[model samples]
Target: MKKQITFSIFITMLLLTACQERTTQQIIKLTNPSDFDRVDEPIVLARNIFTIKDIPNKNCIVLDKDQRAIPFQLDDLDEDGQWDEMFLLVDLKKKEQIDIIVMWTDQMSNKQFRQRANVRFANKAGDKILNDVNRLRSTDTKLSQAEFQMEGPAWENDVVAFRNYFDARNGIDIYGKRTKEMILHKVGINGQNYHQLDDWGMDILKVGTSLGAGAIAISSGDTLYRVDLPETSTYHLLVNGPLRSVFDLKHHNFKIGDHQLNINHRISIWGGAACYKSSVTIDGLQGNDALVTGIVNLHSDTYIEEKADQYLILATHDIQAEDQAALGMALLAKSKDVIDVSEAPKEGSGIVSTYLLKLKAENNKPTNFYFYAGWATQDKGYTDKSYFMKRLKKDAMRWSRPIIIK
Candidate 1:
């Protein structure tokens, strides 16, 4: 009877210890007030203390001071093939604090937790005739094709969308939306039976020779040169998420002037944001060479703002598409890396304004930058050019000052 009693006491102590281990909590604080709804902001747990498996079966809850559950999603932002971060989509008032409790008993079924960001790559399988190097086409029947028939890859979030020409010439492009619903569903193939305004969000802006909306280039003396990755280039969808979408495109042995360059490109878009992030890794670059990425100058009137070592904001409000709506586009980078902000005028496409950033590669690591677009017709506040520029500056500052996590 004594042995039985001792065994019972040991089992009870073990149960208490396990319970204590499961109720671990971590607190995150935002120093400044969030200007927009904090969507998919990651709270990465310490890998030493917690493994991916430790995240309870969808039972994680971000709680307020009063211990109420807030909607959140757990995802792998780094795309390491394992879930590692917990994303919180909260509207905390300025200077408010929040608590994230793992292993909580509350299993709240919030639809926000299931929000998705997607990317699609339609492959050409059975085409018998090989098109020319300049031929623009895509195998996917749901994608939009420009007048040039630029068939590449396309991706979108709820608010904004983007696509890259599959051919070897132009840079990345943007698609603006007025509604929060997925617009790719309504954008029919070859611009055939589709709605640009009421449904498709319209490819309102033209890329035309200029960096349509954040296409990359190389600054060679007085010329801004762009390389077109062949349609046969490898593309991979890294992350398709409840909060973020990420993909990579790699081109091997592409000639840029006299040098053959290998490039790795990765693009990511988060929920509730107008801007998408692009990082480019170039294998071959000589000394005194710089990478140029910028917004296209479709309009003659343009405004450039610079903040020493922090950021540079470029804005243009001009007549876009058939409608004369104000369209604002900006490219932001660390001012310290900026070599110069200049314009390269092509005879066929007029003037293309660009930001030149110093490209320093020692061991094949990529140089990073950001590009964004805003259409007045899509959102109310975006009609004002000043408002769009201010939004860019605010976003740059917020990114530089990340939330404090402990």
Candidate 2:
């Protein structure tokens, strides 16, 4: 009887060990073709398949081949206040297949690099200057010079930085980076003092009257116009992340010609990318007007490449900066929506090369596109136009074909 009892105990211990092994083996596979390491971009996995409920409880983990935990975050992509998606910021080698395990753990490891996205609105009470009864401007004038002054909110990630005007002209601007990490803090370091750069990077690009980098406009007949942010244009920071940052710029009633259009814009930026995604929704459109987005052609030395009906790329690499630096700017958009491309030259403001796309309002949904920039002095690769074009094509392909999540 003692021998039989000991045999039963041993069998029970063996079964428990098997169960633990099975739990640790739960994993998902990621397939990539390039040898280049994909940085802070989110690799989204389906939540329902994994049966994940609470991601922040230290219950979920991504394990590597050695069973070590990889840092990741869960995102509420729909903004319903409920976490539904899983994002892992990792580097996958060229032509490598990686297995990511989702298992229960008591301890979660902190991410080493700055894998998150950040945005700051100039909403401080003291930072506002009353331009008019309906308009408020930023007191910080880091970009202010003899004739040009800018006041608005700024955002950045590990790869790139962007800003939009908060006052009369709601134009978008780009901040070029020399470093791969965060550098927006170096801008306006002291109170009311705007420092363009620290030791890491500086604002190398310029935004004058032309779509300034990726500013949106309304195209009617032969003219392109922009709507100013009124008192009712409420600004909200949506997602502040270690992977993605999103914000909403809403205009309750913006006047475009005779119609008062309600516009909502959600801007998102990911890590390890030079471009930020801009999604805009304009209500009260008659479906006849065209939406125009463009890059500034300050020196008239701009090159455009349009691929049949797939994409339109507008690029400029010229000496158009305060330091006479060669800055490369480009706008990429869908070909079906593009109707025409034109050049609008302003006497003192600079030349605005615009891409016109058909504005189709479907149940008041949002329309989206991407705009990005590169500086020659910031990086050696950007000095070659071919390299910039190749990078753009790679990004476009990646955007088209997202990671397949099982």
Candidate 3:
């Protein structure tokens, strides 16, 4: 009689434990329809994509085919207290389909993943102690003269990093990394020594007066004006996480010729990616006004221009880096959006050492493109021009064809 009672109590306790640990899961199906392999391609899903109702924000996770927990981010985009989207970087072979399990529960799991992407911005507002802030404005100073750390905000993944000038230059620069560790967080914290080669990496690009890496401009007829003159310039930090990081540069009351407009430039970078994505949104356009972005052409005499299956690529490779090494820079856009690539003068009232890419501009629409940087020291494979270009071509193809998720 005693043994029977003990066994019955143990069975009831096990049943209660199973119920408490129950997880609601949904099978997510994704297919790669393209012929090329999609490697670590980022997929963002909405909150309501799953059929599960009243999903809790905590204890949410993703599992692969082997039932291994994958690194994923359930981001709260607007920070209104509710989770917004799920961010994941997945791999899929051509025409291959896989099922990913997404599980969530109201209880806690106490799980933490490794961080690979970073978005950092700091300024010396009162005490010059490098206070981190989400928003900042420019005062129209010279290049790299702004009090902001590293001149402005910088974003980085494990592969590469980039920073923009908060001053009048409105220029962008690159930091080719030698290691895969996150370096930007502790870089300026000690002191501004990124120019010199460290154990992690060094600043590789000399921006000068050019468009730097891939800065925006206004091209009207034979004239070009950099996006430096704004009545007010504000910077907003949106996401800083393990898999993705995004920020925005808002130029309020930007006068492009006679058209006064506001420009919002959003830039995002993903983990293990050597490039960053830019989306420019502008309103109030009239007449023949156009938008443009370009690469610095001071050091590279020749550039390769290719029209791929889905996009146009304009690239340059030469001893253009600050370290005097080979650095490959490419700017790509959809085939329908790119009009042509033009060579700007070596010197002018506008800017210098830049080859302009005239882009199709529409009122209240965003212009999108990806800028890639490859330094030889950062990756020895980048020393080969063909390898560098081929890698970018493959990336362009992957960007054109995304994995369809159901």
Q: Each prediction's Cα lDDT score?
A: 0.59, 0.61, 0.79
Q: What tens-digit string does per-residue lDDT give for candidate 1 at 1-406?
A: 5754654464334335435644435555544345444444533344344443545443454555544455555555455765665555555444555654443423332323445455654533212212222324343323434332224566787778887766555467777776676655445444443224655476666666566777766655555467554334555666666667777777667666667667677887767778788888877776555676777665644556657226655556555533467777777776666666666654454335433333334327677777777887878677776788777877777666566554
- Model 1 spans with C-alpha error above 4 angstroms: 1-80, 104-116, 123-150, 189-195, 220-223, 229-232, 348-363
Which candidate has the top score in TM-score?
3
Tell me each candidate's TM-score.
Answer: 0.75, 0.78, 0.89
lDDT per residue as tens, model 3, 280-317: 98876667667889899888989899987799999998
Q: Report residue 136 deviation for candidate 2 (angstroms).
A: 3.2
Answer with 2 or 3, whichever has the higher TM-score. 3
Q: Extract clashing residue pairs from model 3.
A: 297-353
Q: Itemize residue pairs with steric clashes in candidate 1.
A: 136-149, 168-228
- Taking the tens digit of each residue's C-alpha lDDT, what string does model 2 give over 1-406? 5754654464334335535532333578887655454554468775676653454454454667765546676777676876677767766665667887776544332324355577765433324422212333432334322113235667787767777766556667777666666655445543433335445555555555556777777655554567564337656776666777777777777666666677777788877667887788877775466666777665645566646225656666666544456666776666555666666764543234433333434337777788877767577777677787777776665665455554
